[model samples]
Target: MVQGRIEKLRFIAEEMQIAFHLATNLTDPFFARTIARHILVRAENLIAHARGLRRPLRDAGFDTNAFHTAKEAYATEFEEYFKVARHKIGAHVQDFDFGKRIELWNDIEIVKLSYFVDGAREIYEGLAALTVPGYVPYAVPAELSDPKIVEILHQIQRSLDARTWVEMGTDSLAMARGNTSAVLNTTPVHARAGQLALIRRWIALQLELRGKLAAYPAIARLFKERIVTDIVSFCDCLVTRPVAADALQAMDGLNKLVQAENQSSAAIDDFVAASHFETDLAATRRVRDKIGAHLEIDEAETLPMLLADLNAFDLDKALAFYDRVAAAFNKQCFAVLFLRMYAADGARLYGVTMGHSAVKPFAGVAEPPPAAPPALPLINDEQEYAKNLRRWLDGDENQKGTARDFFWKAFMGSDSIEDIKETEHFGSGTRYHSHQFRKAHQFLLDALSDGLSDFDFKGVLDLVMSCRGGAPYPLSEVLVRCAPHAPVFRQYLICHVLGEIGSEPHESVSDFFDAQAHSPTWAVRLEAVMARYKSFIKNEGVFRTNHKGQTKVEHDALVASMTQAMSPDERLICLLGFASVHTGPLAGVFTTPFNSNYTALQAELEMLILPLLNDDDANSKVAMLKQLIQTHDYVGVSVHIAINLNSGENHPLYAALVDACCRGTIIAASNNQASRHLAISYVMKKDHRFAFEIAGPLADRNPDWIDAQILVAQILGEIVGAEADARKRVSSIRSAYKLSPMQEAALAAVETEVQNRVTRQEE
Candidate 1:
């Protein structure tokens, strides 16, 4: 279902992109008009399909916040506009009132008007000749003509394209493991051969490493310290210090190699000079020696000054130089050379056979000893096999699967389970008891709760799959047991399996959700919230029937009591559940006994939840923001935060809110919820420069977006007026007008303060 929705969205986005291009780029009015008619139709389809993705995506345990945010932004900005255009102009033209101004220009002379025109006379004359002024059949609104609409359409398409890529990559991995025959049939023979060869080399490398490590521990330590640790630190630096610090760290590491009091140091120095990193190295040394390592009284450099000096240094080139030096050091000192391989090329190389026949034998090299075969376990009887299985289930996480493999090998002995059962040495009537299987299942579940490696998790999932159609276990009980601190994937899989089992509504499931509703992991909390909503809808008839005898006052009292009993986090979850039902697939189909509308329910919940934002708990504040995002009340919540910022009450809560909002906005550039709030907060603090810096780029990027222009204009008015830069103030207002001419009225209201400043200056 999720895949179908994703594909539908992809199809709609692609169609929208094509329609948008045709509508915008076509010169012929006929073609433009024809394509323009379908523009809103395609946009409406995209919106519906995009919204349709949320339920299925949530069901699959994927985060849909970004998708949800983008869809809401698109819909909030364009849904009504498109609806009106589609109804009045695009499709239902007869419903439109073109008004009294639609008339024929019967007395106008086209050639004379063109001769009097200042420029582009031929084009003007051509247009005048083609113009049919009487009762214009279809007039596209200026709102639909703005280029920002199409640009946003393109962004939506790009977002879907990225999502589809992720889905396809995930599908490929699952398909390769679950259906080898399908993969084999689909993959090219040469590619398969390369894959096989690469696997052979990998196995050979593992064997070689094991043999070498056992034979010589000293060399392995050298490899670990010199090669592995160095490379790991280098990679860590890349992630932890992506900007100036990365360049500084790379220089520091190179300096150690250069300053060593040995012959190799001289060689490394010469290599650095040869690589043209000498100047960068020298500058780094000066900064470190003069400012960092020792604070000389004569040195007047600050940290920012040092950073500025290193700003011109090419970190990429420096990193590359370091790589070359490391490789040379390895080859010279250890007689080994490293080579880089692209991932695709490496995967392809797996198919090649690593045999003497496949490669020419090297001269003057002795044949190495053959790798020893793996040891097998001694399982003399069923008791021993059972003991080994138990041991495997209780074994070290790192050594997982060892005893299981041994037990399975010894017990099966090239025979099926049925075959072994029939030949069971005078045990013809043997039968397994449910308690024994249940006990073993309990052991597996316990092992999972303790946490397993990915390999062990996969094995456990396989075992769970084998028991699917039999008597259903207390899987919800297991979920409750593991919900507190299990791995996220484990929690998700447990939830997935519970859904698959279709277990009856049980106390254990509800308990699991109630406990997990406040889980630290957002994904787990989201799953719990969604599950609660689904459970509510699934039992809607039962709930309604049970409450039929109660009056509205009694129902409201009962709901209030239940809500009062919940903690802040639980109330937030309850609020999210209400939102899901309100916006969900079955929205409007189900109603409360108290006859509360979605808006009232939402507002009531907000009244309960919003107060907790000032409760001196950062977690509570952050959870509120996340719920706001889910409820499509993020912007409003941010505005509330901005209002509070004016009061200057809670510093920690303000910081936490801003941080969460910033992270939320990372999902898409179009999501300026954080920036808008932050700018407002800064403006209230009287830091107009900071406000302008925060809101200016949003206005530039979304020039035609009225809200962004208004925000920037407000910030700029304060900033420019404070400085009393009259010319700059006038330019700012004019630029806003030029960028969003259709939004002149809105800009006028925002720019009124700037106009007042200009008027005072003129006086």
Candidate 2:
């Protein structure tokens, strides 16, 4: 389902691009009908899944959650179209039948629309035009053509593949009526003649291109550039003279002559919708006829006319044309809003895909990520950019003068006005180094009047600040100069710059209590404060982590340092973070964890958490305290593990919590739950040797270890428990410690009494 949406959105983008290019429509917002349907279809699928689950959940008493989820999803399933049904394109686009573009638009207000235009259009167009299957007569599988040519063919093929498609280029003309750029209607007589002419021209070009390709397939990239030459020529021809019916007739004759010439697939693709020419030419003609019926223009008027004069569209003509187009643009009614619809055509063209070639394309193959292009020249991007900005900031010597001169030049936009206002005080002689407040003020005024890229403005402010280190540059003036409207408000780099000098709503925030209120753009100012808030929020979280990391890193050193110099309790807390780092086995010296080494660490760990176990703060950390209690219950204080713990900083609070567990204090439990909640964590670390511990607590408790053991025994008397099974598992360790020196000494007096009782019972 996800894959389907991706493909559908891709198709929508392709359709939108072709429409935008054809109509030159920068004002209209193109929305894909296919994409909306896909989104709806996906919403429905979610609703269905939710509904299916709601029934079972209802039976189990969780139905309310399921029902609400399903109900909401169902409503959202179709609200997109219904919700956006107000604007001209928005309303019409929501309609099931409406297509991608409206007739008028250009570059001025176009936002996302411009993104769809490839910066590399020339490169791709160049590659596509000459993608002929058999250039010099020898033919292999059409797909086996040159790699670059194959890529080019894919680019053109995918453009017109959208559902509910409209025509563009020659296809539009062929159809005779459609939202089209230009069209060609091949009358039977024109067809024969044009085919012959096209064939002769096609053969000649093919032989030349093949020779070029054979000589250097790598450079074969140059031959296929889009028709820049053709467009320029046509524009010039149009400017040279007004069109007449006779001229139109002559143009028609010329098109007819070409129609007779080209039967080659490559030449066909060079025109619009060429990839589909083989199967859909006649169908295209039908669609064009439908569009023409509505446009009031005659079908014949849709065709592009050929011209003899190619140099007519010179500098003056081009300027005049732009002026007229610019005047037609109504800012209030329509603005070009750039649209960024990710077509991901390259990924689709190259990746494993589904559903294009009937059932075959849908075969079992997963999509692969698109290949990244080889390294193009990284080129002198920033350097050249900076130089251009320098020229803009400080007027070019040939055009104007220095930075001060450039400011006036930018504001006036004409040399005559600049000349009238020119003063030595505001020209090449002006220097920021003098710390002249008036000059700085003038510079700021000049900057505001003459528009500059964000980079240039930022550069100017930085340079000024550098010149006057201790000068009375107020915070208000500084911010007004650099962050005026706050476009880079959230950028930390900008924040850092501001911080170095000082600004509002920060450590020095009180100084500009009201300066921020007059912000031009709310979005930009809000982000500045948000950036500061985000910084503190981020660091506080980091502080706790650093604490743990530092604790871990210092653990080993602490343990060693305290070994002979400090008491056991003082050294124990320092080892907590390190002990937590590793939980598994180590080399041979100490055997199993049950060895005396563990008993020592276990004894020490108990002493650590014992003192604070009942403290209010420790109790407040119930979860951590509870785990500490459990660790003590199951593994006891592991002094063996404690000495080995190496501290590193990952989580300071985590290690700190462990420190509270091992050293802060001990918990005195009046009930079983209290004693069962310790945060002790222990594990076997020694190698194959008998590694383990002999457990005992160092401190006194409300219910001591012996007392707790008795309680377990009393509970056993009342009911059978895991004790019956636990005894068997502990038998080996219990036996080993059963007659130890400490045990024997304590049981010495009971030995005779136990023997007498057993003897009497046997009798």
Q: Residue 602 CA error for candidate 1 (Å)?
A: 3.4
TM-score of each: 0.25, 0.16
Name model 1 segments beyond 4 Å from true. Answer: 1-447, 453-478, 484-504, 513-534, 541-561, 566-577, 584-597, 603-763
The per-model lDDT (C-alpha) reads 0.40, 0.29
lDDT at residue 452 of model 1 (Cα atoms)? 69
Model 2 segments more than 4 A misplaced: 1-34, 38-372, 376-558, 561-570, 583-603, 612-626, 629-763
RMSD of each: 31.9, 34.3
Residues 21-136 of candidate 2 have per-residue lDDT tens digits of 32231111121221122222222233333334334445544324433543454345234332232111121111111121212111112332233323112212221233322112
Tens-digit lDDT track for model 1 on 476-503?
Answer: 4444565557666666556545533433
Instruction: Tell me how candidate 2 scores on lDDT.
Output: 0.29
Report model 1's TM-score to 2 decimal places: 0.25
Error of 1 at 29 (Å): 40
- Model 1 clash count equals 11
